[model samples]
Target chain A: AQSVTQPDARVTVSEGASLQLRCKYSYSGTPYLFWYVQYPRQGLQLLLKYYSGDPVVQGVNGFEAEFSKSNSSFHLRKASVHWSDSAVYFCVLSAQGTGSKLSFGKGAKLTVSP
Target chain B: GPKVLQIPSHQIIDMGQMVTLNCDPVSNHLYFYWYKQILGQQMEFLVNFYNGKVMEKSKLFKDQFSVERPDGSYFTLKIQPTALEDSAVYFCASSPWDWGDTQYFGPGTRLLVL
Candidate 1:
């Protein structure tokens, strides 16, 4: 079965510091990966996605993710963090040809402090 | 910009009572999905709907759970005889095309069963 794993449950970083949220997926075949962010009491918002080409994909709020097929990893990164960027980040995966059902990681809680 | 909306941001119900969570997908979206996230847990896929039928459902989608997109209006998730374990945040999302497309999620409906 396809699964997603987010190694960190909580990560604290200073404002204006660089950020990286780790994600790894387990799948039998080609995988479609996505990164989503959730604020308190808000819905999940898409940050970035990796389907086929370009190992690096850019997303909203100055976020980007690099997809590595060999390592089955799609790690999210931000050049600088803001206090407003503190939120829960989820890594999601879907099989190449399946429907819209996604298997999501347990999420990493990011705290950007001043 | 298109968005999804979920009705009844929060609800408290007695165990064994039936509850219906409502969602309105984007106007031009062709695929709809439901996901559940228990407090402090990752969001998990419940089901996906398209073309007036269910395209996929995860094992967590019990028999008591049903989804409908009647008249192309609200997409609803009805849980019959809700259990205590049913307490979670249910999110509705829609994609303009299919699974590979970026999904827009609604503010989730938090359901608590007592």
Candidate 2:
């Protein structure tokens, strides 16, 4: 079965500092990766996605993720984060032949202190 | 951007009772999905429905859980004889025909079973 691991349960960063959230997946075949962010009292929003093509994929609000097939990892990165960026980040994985269902990681709670 | 809307932001019910959560998926979306998220935990896939039938379901989708969308109405997930373990937030998502594309998520319905 395909699964995701976020590793970090919580990460605190000072405002205007860079951030990198690590994600690792266990899948036999090629995997489609996604990064989603959820704000307080709101629905989850797509930050970015990586299926094929260039390793680096850009997303909304200055968010981006790089897909590494060799490492089986797709980590999200932001050069600088603001207080508004504080939220829960989730790494998701999807593969062929599973009805396009997505498996999500345990999620990382990001807190940006001002 | 498309939006998915879930009704009854929060629901409280006793164990052994039935509860129905409604989700209004994005217009023209063909795939509908349900995900469950326990408090402070990651969101997990429960089921995915398309063309009035279930395409896939995870092991977490117990026999007590069922999903349907009648007459092009809201996609509904009914949990009969709910348990304390079923107390969690249920989120609905939808995507266009492109199975590998992004799925828009709803705000989620918080269910508490006592």
Candidate 3:
């Protein structure tokens, strides 16, 4: 069975600091990866996704993710963070021919400190 | 921007009761999904419905669970004889066409079973 793992349950960083959220996936074939952010009392917002081609994919809010096939990892990164960036981040995986069903990680709660 | 709406943001019910969770997916979307998230736990995929039929369902989708989109109305997830274990947050999502495409998620409906 394909699965996604986000090792960190929570991460705290000061505003303007660099941020990285690690995500590792287990699948036998090429996997579709995505990063989604959920604000308090709000639905999830897509941050970025990786299907093919470029290993580094840029997304909204200055967020980007790097997909490494050898590592089976797609880590999200931002050069600088803002307080508004504090939210729960989920890493999702979809295998080929799954018909839109996504496997989500436990999620990493990021808190931007002042 | 597309959005998905879920009615009854919160619901409190007793065990063995029937609960219906309503979801209004993006108007142009063709695929709908349901996910369950227990407090402090990872969100788990429940089922996906497309073109008025179930496309795929996960192991978490219990026999008590059913989904329907009647007359192109709100997509609904019904839990018959709801169990205590069913107390969780349910999120509804939809995608435009392909299963590997991005999905828009709802704010989620929190169900409390006592």
Specify the highest-DockQ model's number. 3
Interface RMSD of 3: 0.9
- Which residue pairs collide in model 1, if any? none
**Reference-based TM-score of each model:** 0.96, 0.97, 0.98
Q: What is candidate 2's local distance difference test score?
A: 0.93
* B-chain TM-score for every candidate: 0.97, 0.97, 0.98
lDDT of each: 0.92, 0.93, 0.95
Ranked by TM-score, the better of candidates 1 and 2 is 2
lDDT of 2 by residue, B1-114 (tens): 788999999999999999999999998999999999999887899999989999989899999999999999999999998999999999999999645789999999999999
Quote the positional error of residue A58 for candidate 1 in Å: 1.4
Q: Candidate 3: TM-score?
A: 0.98
Candidate 2, residue A46: the lDDT equals 93
Candidate closest to the true structure, highest lDDT: 3
- After superposition, candidate 2 runs with Cα above 4 Å error: none
**Candidate 2 local lDDT, residue B12:** 98
lDDT (0-100) at residue B11 of candidate 2?
99
Each candidate's DockQ = 0.81, 0.75, 0.86
Count of backbone clashes, every candidate in sequence: 0, 0, 0
How much DockQ does model 1 earn? 0.81
